[model samples]
Structures are given as structure tokens and as C-alpha cells.
Target chain A: MPPTSEPSTSDTAQPTDADALQAEVTRLRELVGPDEAAYTSLKIELWAARDSAFGAEMAAGELRGQVKVLEGQLAQANRNRRWMVERIKAPLRRVKAILR
Target chain B: MARYSILTPVYDPPEDVLRACLESVARQTFQDWEHCLVDDASTQPHVARVLEEYAAKDRRFKVKRRAANGGIIAASQDALELATGEFVCLLDHDDLLTKDALFEVDLIASTDPSLDYCYSDEDYLSPDGKFINPFHKPDWSPERFRSQMYTGHFSVARRDLVIEVGGFRTGYEGSQDYDLVLRVTEKARSVRHVAKILYHWRMMPESVAQNAEAKPWAYEAGRRAVQDHCDRTGRRATVVDGVVPGVYRVQREIEGEPLVSVVIPTRGSSARVWGVERCFIVEAVRSLVERARYTNIEIIVVMDAPAPAGVIEKLERLAGDRLKIVWYDKPFNFSEKVNLGAAHASGELMLVLNDDIEVETPDFIETMIGLIQEGDVAMVGAKLLFADGRLQHAGHLYNHDPFHAYFGYPANHLGESSVLACQRETSGVTAACALVKMSIWNEVGGLTPELAANFNDVDLSLKIRAKGYRILWTPYAVLYHFESMTRIPTVNLDELKVMRERWATPLKNDPYHNPNFEPLRDDWVLRSR
Candidate 1:
């Protein structure tokens, strides 16, 4: 009989210390697979979030432009509604003539 | 043996201004011209003296004094009779021609001998001799000409065409030149526009340039002349005075009540509009059915699959027989939905409308139909207003980029040159409420699906224009657009790149927009760059 736990000429077909270590490493990789996939997905979401923020900033800039235009239009409307000098002076001149 | 003959009808012009006018002609760089000046019995003594002096100095200045004071038309006819050149150029008594005016005209004429008519940009000369308000006119806008005499100054026409059009009519005294231009242009073989300020219009106290109300009869004459042009052109239209004095509106009569297919693409979205939460699609269909004056419209709603069933039922109840619902189970693409709705439509005309739109003008459909019926105009857009009654779109201006003319201006804001009050040709119009012929829509393959959300209408407009069809935008048709209420309109950078690549030339050079205008600006302000 050969030594039971020791390596012999036919020991290559048996599970040795190196083979067991390789099997343990394979099991650990299988355990971390789902978490690695989740991390990659989170990275992709981060990039999308950055893109959305940039889009929001651009939209905000356009809204600012719109606000400026609206303000200008308001000023123009006010000007249009204001009484002209000729119109005001005409009434004043008529009142002065009546007083005279 | 002169190449050009200038006609000037004098009537009590200030001596200094008249002399300056004559001197301006005399100082022309191109000397192959003769000035035919007719004095209509001026009460001022210096008028005759200045006329005689100009005539004596240069034989090109031929002066004639009338026995009695005939009006401007008669004086112009007399001056016309004295013309012995190939082309006759109209000049006012007080207005001065730029030094290179004749040279520019001759240069273009030399290139194109068949050029029957030519006009140029002009500016106003104040009483203090300061040049202000330069009119940088666009290239040969016949629709704009019908709205107003934009090509009033530096008008040059072939002598034979002028004579054939009967020179100037007696009845059109105040607006004789406008009448002549309309008649001449009707039969013109080719028309050219010189994009240079070749005339300085002297603004006297009584001049129409100084005060629009100074000549009230002129507006009436212009209206009549426009109506006459319409009648001659076999268009059943009426000309009416516009909101402004000089501009005229052509109210075209629609022939038959052609069925219009209103294609609206929506997600059955709702927003707090004017402090009321309302479903956009329901209100849009309701307004089309109930509020619009034109009732011969079929509403086709292309609703997304995720849309509420209640909105569909409401639209069905509201629109009754005029309603057609098409389910869109795909991703959101405005262009694709519009195409799908249009595919199911059975109408002569197709109106591409956004669901966030509400009909403001009762005759909005009728107005668009009338405009689309005009010459070669395949597309007509309504004046869209924001919810707060601010202008959203007047017309599209593609100056290196697409911009809405007078965007965010007040609803009543008469744009630079009363553009808002007039119906005219534009580079493009928004699809928010655009009416196009079904044939043209099919020809252009409808809105480009690649564009999806942004610039789809602009792409369609350019395609139609490329096929020699005109696109018109009228303030006559108005609607309120709750813009981007249903969706956030973020510009896709890819779509912009596609637009730049496809419509590079047209985007840079808009025929309706002047080159001197600022690029990327909605207002017609002069470019500082």
C-alpha cells in the first residue's frame, strides 16, 4: 500500500491542494458576478444623469432668453399704450385756448 | 441715345431739395442716362430757375413746364412722353438718387437683357439731411409687393413694358407708381432686385415717408390698385386697409369648402393652463369642432398607447362624426405620429397641429384655406400665441439658424415693416398649426421621421420650397399654443447636425430675410458683425 494522503505516480488524477485552491477561486468569482454587473449598470446611469443635467442647463438657458424677450415685449406694449406727446399737448393746448 | 431715362414730376418742391435731387442725377457714375423733368406749374419762382439751370448745364436733363397744374399722374405722363431711352426709371421730385444707382442698374441690365423690371433698397433723408431708416429690401418679393409698395424707390422698368402697362393711370394719382409696378410686374418676363440703397427719399413735412397719415388718399388708391391687380390676375380677392396705413391685406375668397384633415399627435397630456388643469388633446379637438368657424374639417388624433382612455372618449363625444383615432404603440416621435394620422386622413388639405394648441381665431381654418389658395403657396401657417397672449411665431427666419420672427412679442406688435399685420411669403413656418396640401405633403414624404421632434417642420418647409412651392404665414389665422406643455422640447444635437448638413445653403441664405440683418436674431435689427 502507498501513503494514503501523499502524492504518488497516479496522484495527478486525484484532487490536490492546487486544484482545490482553483476551485475555491472559481466559486468566489461566481459569488461576485451579480454585484459587478450592478456596478457597471450604476456607472451607465451616472453618465446618463450627467447628460440629463447638461440638457437641463441648456433648457434653462433657452428659458432665460425667452424671459428676456418677454420683458422686452412688455416694455414695447407699455410704450404702445402710453399717450403720445402730440396727443397730450393737443388737449393741453385746447384747454389753454378755452381758458383764454 | 441714352441707355436710361429718369422721370421726375415736380410740384412746388423746396428749391434747395429740388436742386439737390437734380444734382444727384447729374453726379451719376454711369452717364448714359437722361433726366426728363416736368414742372407742374409750380408757384415757386426758383423751381423754373433750377430746372432751366440743370437743363442748360447737361443736355441729359430735359425740362418741360406745364401751362396748368396737372396732378402727379398727368405730370408723370408728360415726363414719360419725353423719355427716349431703353429703360425708364421713376424718381420723385424731392428724392435724390445715389451716385452709383444708374451704374448698378446698368451693370445688371448688361448681364440680363431680358430683365423687364428692377428695384433697389432705399433710405429716408431727414429734413436735417441726415440719412436714417435704411430699408434693406429682400429679393423680388411679389407677395410683399401686394401687401405694400416695398420696392417703391429706384424702380426701373423697360420703356416698352411701361408703355404697354399704360404708363400711369389718371385715377391712381397718389399711388401711380404702385399701380404701374403692379401692372408691369404682372407681364414681366424677369424681375431683378439690386440689394443696395440706391435712392434717398427726402422726408418733407407733408411727405408720406415722414408721416404715414400725411397722405390718406394714397392708402385708398393703393387698396384699389391691389384689388385691380387681383382682378386682373383672376383671383377672387378683396383688398382691405391693414392695421397700419401703407400696408394692404388681400382677403382671398376660397372657392369650395375643401375638407381639411387635422392631424394632431398627442400623449393625452395635461397641464395647468391659466390655472386650470386640462387634458390637451380633448381641448384641442373640442376647439376644432366647436370654436372654429370653418366646420368642414376632420380631426384625426394620433394618441400614444399610454394615453388615457377617458381623453379618447371625450374627443369622440366632442368631435362626433369628424373624429378619427389612430393608436400609436411605438416610442414618441412627433413626425411619425403625424405621418400615421395623415396616412389615415382622407382630405384635400392636411393641417399638422400640435395637441397643446387651442383655436383662438374663429375663422382660423378659413383664413389658412384662403392663403393656401393663393399662387403656388402650398403651405400656410397660423400666427401662434403663447398662453399669456404673447406672440409665439410670426414666421420662420433661417439666418444661419431657424428663429421665429417676432417671437414673444405682444400679440398686437406690428413687427418691423408691419410684417405681423401682413400675409406674406416666408422662409418657413412652424408646424404647430400649419396647413399644407395633401399632394405636397405626400410629395415631400411628409415630415422627416429622422427629425422626430425638432426642426421637422423646417425640413418640410425647405423641401416644399425646393420643389418651387411657396410657404406663407399670416397674422390673419391665430391660435394659442401651450408650447412644450405635453413634452420638454430639448434640442437633440444629432438633429441639429442633420439639419446643418441637409439645408446648409438655405439656412445661411434666406431669400425673405435680408443679409444685413443679424444672424440668429428674431428681430430685424442690423447686424453689428
Candidate 2:
């Protein structure tokens, strides 16, 4: 709170290098503004990539489930076709035996 | 408080076996252990008397009796429930542990409290209590464990994980230990192997260890165990009985008919063989084409032309249309020759075979291809025998030395010893007759040309393993490898230095070789250090 004398002309002319450096840093900051928006957009891009991978994994799992079901159905259909062929042949063989 | 609870279930075990088992536990140097003896309603009065005597003598001994004849699984579960220790080890009543078994387990548990599971090396005990046939096991090898329960006996697990995996399954009685081990290892946070023979599995005539016929159910259960393991892990494989009893063969089916490229790098020279002047390449090619059952293979023979004159023409004549001869005009580099041959190879699978090798098994290609067909496995090697019929290359291992575990025993050696008798996971196998996936070969950038001779295969194996691929050694794929028949041996110190520098850590410590063992010997001897 003590009031000091104002800087003499000589003292003001020879400013400390640190003060000059700080002034240059502030001027550069003013020119470039802030990188906060760029970083936020970068975070958003990374999250989007993660979500895309997760969605692909889910889709692949669902497709595999559907394939497994289809395979089971095909196996059942093949078994039924074999059974029908055997059933048709069974009567035919019996009739032929009777004729003989 | 006790740190380890040993669960040993006794049925109608022989009195001597039961006494020996109990005596081993009683004589433990580590006092912080509880022997949880569960009697599965033994009809023999002596078994119960022995259990009661142990319980009365030692406060650390806990005994429980099943109402009916509950199998080993139920008895194990009952003993697990009775356990108050941090970790529990399963012991068979007929087996004996080394005096330091409990001490070793306690040491690891106390030192590294984070370890969830641990196993020790084991051997077999004859009926007369003579310890023999010690299995000096490797460190924690998940790939090897998947093929067979290499860490079967003296396996200790944290009590919480054991209880969480539901102690033991009901129907996997004969192979209850295998089932429990599979479950425990699946849920394990960390696994450790003591690398010392701390357990001795006794073999009685009626015991499953001695005779598979004693309980056919055990083999069936083992098959189911491996199949279930495959199912659980989603490793698409078909499990079947191996050539040996109590061992299972896991055959992985290939997607389609993949062409196999057989690259036999040789120097086309005529040498006197058993008083007959003949070219080895001619006969080797003939042997391969005539013997190998798999017909879908193309032979790529790389040879230096000027060294042997007309030998190339003779090889080409014998090889016929299937042969692709690459003239290796440059100085001899085994690694470069193989790489050059690989570049010319058209098959999906590349078999780096030596020209001196005579294919023994008709199903050599079929067997090796079946193994490498698994997506996880990168390569599979064969059991090679010398010209005189002694073993040459059972499986190649970097036992800190350039080589170890290659027993050139008698031609008619009993196929019982641990090393060559069964199919197992190995760190590296000699490229002499190794079948590797071409994609994997490309991935690891083929053999290191800088390592032209000595450790080219080892460097390639380490590189392949670095890519998270496993290598296997199978005895089923047998071949007679007349090792280095045409090639003159020379050691370049520069190449050796490159090898040592490239694999400094692995050279110092091989995962396939036990830490207790010295680098020069396959036999597990306590290292001086």
C-alpha cells in the first residue's frame, strides 16, 4: 500500500529482459488466440472412432448369430430330405420283395 | 494362520501309499499349512484309521468324511469348503510330494501375494516309492497348457479363485483336476511355475497314471476336457486321442486346399555316401515326392550352379515339373537362400526343409499342415532322426545355449521320456524341416540374413513369437534328417555377435527352459547361482 516514486527515464529505458519477454509472449498469444476449440474437436473425433468400432463389433456379432441359425435350419432340412427319401424307398423295396 | 490348505482325498488307497502321502505332508519344513484330508467313505478300515491318527496328532490336519462314495470331485469340494488358508493345493492320496513342496508354494505365495495360481515340476514314483522320470516343466506357457495339462500336479491356486470357479465340476471325475485347472487358469490374474520337481505322481498298476485301461473313462474325460476348453475359448479345433494314452491330439482344420511350398536349400554337390558317389538332393527330392502323402506341394530347390556342374540338371530331371530351381549366384547365405526360395514360392504354407532330410512319415505334410492351420499357431516342426536312427532334432530349444534337449539316444529309445514322446509347444524348432505359414514368414520378414547360419531359425522364431504367434513341435510328423549332409559348417563371429545382441534377454532366459536348470543341460539341475 506504500506509494513509490515513478520510474525514472533511465530505468524505463532499460527494462528487464524478463519483462520484455513477457510482453512478446502476450503479443503472440493475441495473434494466435486459443487452441481449446481444436482440442475439443480432436476429442470428439476420437470418441466417434471408438463408437464406430463398437457398432461394427455389434453388427458382426449379430450377423454371426444369424449365420448360425441359418446353418442349423439347413442341417435340419437336409435331415428331413434324407428321411423322406428313405421312407419312399422303404415301401418300394417292400413291394418289390412281395412281387419276387 | 495357515497360508496353504492341501486338499488330499483318499478313497481305498493302499495303506503304504496313504502313509507315504501323509508322511510327506507331515514332514514339511513350512509349518503354515493345513492338510485337509477328506475320506470318501472308504470301506477299508485302515484309511479312516490313518486319517483319524493324523487329525489327532497334528492340529493342522483337518479330516472330513463323505456320507456316500462321493467321487474325487465332491471330496475336493468338501475339502475346499473346509479350507481356511489363502491358497489350496490338490494332492492325490496315492501321490507323494517332495519335502519342500509346501515350503516352495508358501514361499511364492508370501513373496508375490498377487500370484493367483502356481504349479511345480513333477515326476513319477514307481510302486516301490522310487522317484523316476522327472518332468522339469517350463515357466507359465499358456500355449503349451492348452495342448496338454503340462502343469497337472502340485498346482496351487488362491482360495478365492478356486471357490469362485466352483471348486470342481461334477462329471469330470477322472479328470477332475484338469477341469478345475482349466477353470482356475481361465480366471487367474497371474500364474507362476516353481520349476522344481515338488510333486511325485505314483504309478500303480491300477492307477490311471500307470494304465489308461485302468480307467477308460479318464481318457474320455480328458478328450471332453480339451474339447470343452476349445469350445470355451472359441479356438476352433477337433480333439481326438493322441498316439499315446492320456494325451490328446488337437487337429485344426484348414479352410481350403492350400498349396504347400517345400523349399529345400542345398549346394548341388556329389559326395560319397556309404561308399556310393551320389547327389543327396536327387534322392531327397525322390524321397519327398514318393513318401509325403500330401500331393499338393511344389518343391523349390535353391542351389549354387558352378560348385557342382551337372548336378543341377540331374536334380531337375529327378524333380520333374513340380520343381522350381532358383540359381543362388551369390555367396552362400542359408538365410538368404531360404528367403530367395520363399520369394519364388507360390504356396500359402512354406516348408523350410533341408536337402538331406528323408521324409519318414507318409503323413508328414498332412500332420504339420493340420497344426499350422490353427490361426494362433505360426509354425510346426517334425521329429528328425539321424541316419544311424538316433534322434537328431526332437525339438529345438534355446536353453541359454545355442541348443539343448536334443538327445541322440539309441535309435530304439523308449518313447516315454518327456522331451520327444509327445506333441508340445516349443519356443523354436530348427528350420531343417519346419512348416511355417507363409503369411507369418512374411510378417516376421523371413529369416534374418545377417544371421546366415547359426541362429537364423531362432531369430526368426523370436520375431514370430514377438508377433504373438505360437510355435509347436510334434513327434507325429517324423523325418530322418541327415543334418548338414552337403553344407560345410562355418561360424562367423560377427553373425554370432548379432544373434547375441538381437536376443540378449531370451538368450539369458529362455521361457522353454527352466530357471533351476543350467543352459547346457536339458535335465533340471539346480543352477549354481
Per candidate, the number of residue pairs that clash is 0, 0
Q: Per-residue error at B60 for model 1, in Å?
A: 1.0
Worst 10 residues of 1 chain B by lDDT: B520-529
Please name the candidate that would achieve the greatest lDDT relative to the true structure: 1
lDDT of 1 by residue, B1-529 (tens): 6899999999988888898899899999999999999999999999999999888888999999999999999999999999999999999999999999999998899999799999998999998879988888778778888998888899999999999989999887679999999999999998998888899999988889999999999989999999999999998999998889989989889989999999999999888665457799999988888899898889998989866867876887799889998999998888999999999999999999998988988988988898888768899988997776667889898988898887766677786777778888899999999999999899989999999889999999999999999998888888988885235569999999999999999999988878876677777766432
Pairs clashing within candidate 1: none
lDDT (tens digit, per residue) of candidate 2 on B217-246: 877887798888878877667888865566
Runs in model 1 lying further than 4 Å from the true structure: A1-100, B484-488
Docking quality (DockQ) of candidate 2: 0.00
Give the top-scoring candidate (TM-score).
Answer: 1
Error of 1 at A52 (Å): 36
TM-score, every prediction: 0.84, 0.71
Q: What TM-score does prediction 1 earn?
A: 0.84
Residue-level lDDT of model 2, residues A1-100, one tens digit each, is: 8999897667547666587779877776665568646655766886776666545644554554355445544654565577688889999999999999
- Candidate 1 has a DockQ of 0.02
Q: How much is the lDDT of residue B482 in candidate 2?
A: 65
